[model samples]
Target: MVGLLVLAAFLTLADRWAVLYAEHRAADALKDRLKLTAAPEVEIDGFPFLPQFVDGRLGSVKVTVPDVSADRITLASVSATARDITLDGDGPTSVHGARVPELNGDVLLSFADLNRELGASQVTFTGEGRDRVLARGTLPVAGHDLRLRADVRIGRAGDQGIATTIGGMRLDVGDLATYRPGARASEGLHLTPKSVTRLARETRKVRALLGVPSVVRRMGVPDATVREALRNDDKLAALTGSRDFVHQAMRVNLLDLTLAHPEVLDRLGLDPALLDALSRLTRPVLADQLSLGFRLPEPERGELWLRDVRVEKGGIRVRLAGQGLAFGD
Candidate 1:
């Protein structure tokens, strides 16, 4: 009985040694096969190694790799579980090839890493709902820092691409108004009722309007009436206090107005460069900045594709699947 117990202990140690050696070999092989920057951590499950080794099959294997660069973005980490792995050699040390019947993985794009990599405009992304994310930050435009907020939807673009659709992107132009970028001037700067009312009360703004004689003339106010209002505070207030003027001002297409009368920008203390910048920030261009679309690199040995996308607290997670994966075959 004592002799049997000693033999059992020896077998157990030998079994453990075999598993470790196999794991090391598998890690190195995968690193080379996947072209990974470093060897991934590999673990084979369902121990009592000798039987599985003899049969040349591993029931389950887990692999994790970090900092995988995919297109313009970097995946924080990628983890996968491969199942029904069939080894093609007599033993661990002599193993030359293997086949994975099925595998599922998760590619995590952590917000911290995203902020460091894709946050060129100081914009940062955060998960909004199960399928959406919110981007908020500042964009530099013509020497002024403009605040921006956007709602983005997460979805699969193709079999292996994850994409973002931006909606309701707004840029704040100080206290003047919110700019809604678009393909045409009809969808330009918009002023809320409160902003319109506030503008009517600002003395400097009222003075600036009076300073532009052409604008006064276009408003159908005679030069004498404008001169009189320029001297008397009550006259100027009465002239700007009319309901029709305030209502029309709120509905004015600032972009069209500025394009038609370039002097309007000067009168409003806005640089012409600001308009040039806004012209280039159309809907599509702005959306491109927040686009998270990326395609996974095709592996040399097997089929891999993106399955789904989800917005999680950590970041955007894209589900991946693979089949018939083989190494060194």
Candidate 2:
């Protein structure tokens, strides 16, 4: 009996030591993968007396990297920390007090002092048969400050896409104007290129449905061709006095009227033929460019500002310094 008791004790010690060693190795591997300068400090306080398993407590770890640079901006520090770790079973783990710092100017446009006031970032993950992640953070840009909070669930079926929704967002346009003067700070900004293109299409649709004569003229379709078509086509001529006829004429001119003689259309609108040529027009440009400028208030500040941004033909350009500035968006 005495020998059996001694053997059990040795096995318990061995299991405890192995668990601690595994934890240390995992932490060290994470540090190397992240290219951090310092290894995380880990501690395990309590051991399961019955099962000989180690329970981690009062654990704190930090990793830091210095001198990160990208796109002409240099960042002085990137640091992350994990605290108060608790592991239950071999498959499930819980951690609290996780913090990660933003990458300052290296990844952002302009450096702002307000970033320090935003506080530390955090993320949490819980896994059962699948994994779920929740994250919250803040970031600063040249013209605005962003706050984000989101939750993501993984391992879902079908092409339904990950479910995401903005919890809260606040933009400080007033602060942005300080960097670029005479910019319209109050103009609500849309960051997504797809939405902007959709808006342009919707606008054209509404104009056509309303029979807006000026808009039809601007679309480079000769009003003369439309007027002549209405005169010759008996079915169309009968409906000329009706509002629906006006809408139909505009729609047809926009969609099908390709004028062979552009001069006829130009003379009708009192404009030159070159202006009515739609050969290279009407193509929506997609903009994938990053903009770094301040939103300015009225009564110009003698500083250059971005105005009237337009995306067309898979290209994005902004009006700045009294001229259109082209940039890859």
Candidate 3:
């Protein structure tokens, strides 16, 4: 009886290895099919597999794809669980194909990944300790790039899915001389968007106020609407007052803005950096598809259901459920 037990144990262990080896091969095939950057983690659930191996069936199988970057956005992971998988009975040496009952899983995408997609040159994102994210980056103000940081609060955007809002809008100069009088001696008027007119075309009016340069107002508008800073000459002088070399810097930073067309990039006092800021968000990212949930109907001859998604830290974790799996040669 003891010898028989030893033989059974060995057979079970060997059977498990065989199943794992076969799974590795299948995962390789899956990798090719999905065009994955890396092969996913695969596991067969339960133990003492000799019986299941002989029958060419599996109780359940789990698969995890660590990172799925559909476009600019990267989902942390996508997991699926297959239940009651029926394998090709003819492939005794290798379990090929399966009939699944029902499969369910989750796809997780976190805020950190979003920041990563923002690019290394952009701001770095940090966790706010409570379910929130903090990001700091240079903002374009008055055509100048100013140091700015914003707290992105999570909120739902009606039918648009999850959304974010900017908070704690603050823009500052690194050199005291830029804002402080006679400290290091800067050039031009270092102003923010708020210092200028509230309208887009009015961007030209900002330069007029700084006493920098003039602009040819676009067609079909009131002259007063497109008035140059020279019109605000008195106000421009008042703006300088005693603010030392700052008058020489002539750079303006635009901050906390809702919208600006790329056409206004050539406007002065506007940091060319605004090009990055405007283009970065406007280039048409695949963010919509990333935010949208996904479902794989026949991953393994069964439907793998993707139900819920939760974002955390650098990655996401998902739970899976499955059904109606059928395996054939």
Candidate 4:
């Protein structure tokens, strides 16, 4: 009897050990799929993992990823769960339709970084950049060149990208005209590409103050082409009220449109053809790109699908779900 009891206890312990081991394997595989440098926090629910292993199915899976970055922007946290997962010979078989409960993405573009993009390296950041970042230097705001102290507020520009609105109302050096970003700091000031011509209708001004006309002239397409592109967009059709002649309203340029209301993109279809055209006109090598989103890499052949996008403090948390996500072979 003693021998039998001892054997049973050993089996129980081994079962628990194997469960954790399997959990780690799944987590590691997930990490690779997400392009994470470290193993994500993974948990598998169900007791006596051995039985589930033999059956080739798990009850549930939860994973926590700390950081994920495509380029300049970084997603701070990502937590997700999936039900009825299949364990495959190589690893966890592609989980179909995972649920993402919570995810956080933020980018800290220091004052220095912002300046580099603006090509105004003369400006420098002061103190910390958490709540507010102060840009101290001279910038050509509005019409006049002024030595100014600008308060930069960072927030979600739209469904994607970050927006820095400079307007805490402080001109330490010049007259009332000294701090001249525009006549009205109160107006909504957004940054987006010129090609995204729809954005100018809403914002105080597009960031095309410099050579926008030249760029627009370079890619002058007939109004007919723009109209054709809009017609192809079915999503934009469903969400908005009435679709009118929106081509003449659009000037030819190599910039993404940062609409006053970014929520519109959510309604746009997922075809990416129209957006690709708008986002592609941009010549990153020629000039500073005023993009409006995290600009994540294009998905590779059904790897994952972005479901929802929410703007939060620090960065935008985009929800993504995958059906059978596979890793490097």
Highest TM-score among the candidates is held by which one?
Answer: 1
Local accuracy of candidate 2 as per-residue lDDT tens digits, 34-88: 4556554444344442242334332443334453332222333433333343333
Clashing pairs for predicted structure model 4, backbone only: 94-324, 141-180, 160-293, 161-293, 161-294, 195-255, 196-256, 196-257
Q: Candidate 2 — worst ten consecutive residues by lDDT sum?
A: 283-292
Q: Listing every candidate in turn, what is its Cα RMSD in Å to the true structure after a full C-alpha superposition? A: 4.0, 21.1, 10.0, 19.2
What's the lDDT of the predicted structure labeled candidate 4?
0.44
Candidate ordering by TM-score (highest first):
1, 3, 4, 2
List per-prediction Cα lDDT, in the order shown. Answer: 0.80, 0.32, 0.50, 0.44
TM-score of each: 0.83, 0.22, 0.55, 0.42
TM-score of 1: 0.83
TM-score of 2: 0.22
Q: Any runs in candidate 1 off by more than 4 Å, and if so which?
A: 89-92, 184-186, 191-195, 202-239, 242-247, 257-260
The residue-by-residue lDDT of candidate 1 on 1-329, one tens digit each, is 99999999999999998888878988888788778999888888887987987888889988899999887788899999999989887675577888988999999998888888878879998998888889999988888888999998989877878877899888888877678887453367765567678878886776766566555654566788678878988988887787755654555555655666676556565667787788778899888888877887777788999888889999988889999888776
Residue 307 lDDT in candidate 4: 55
lDDT per residue as tens, model 3, 242-315: 24313222343222121343233344334555434433432123122123233333444544443333345664
**Residue pairs in collision within model 2:** 177-295, 284-313, 285-312, 285-313, 285-314, 286-314, 287-329, 288-329, 289-329
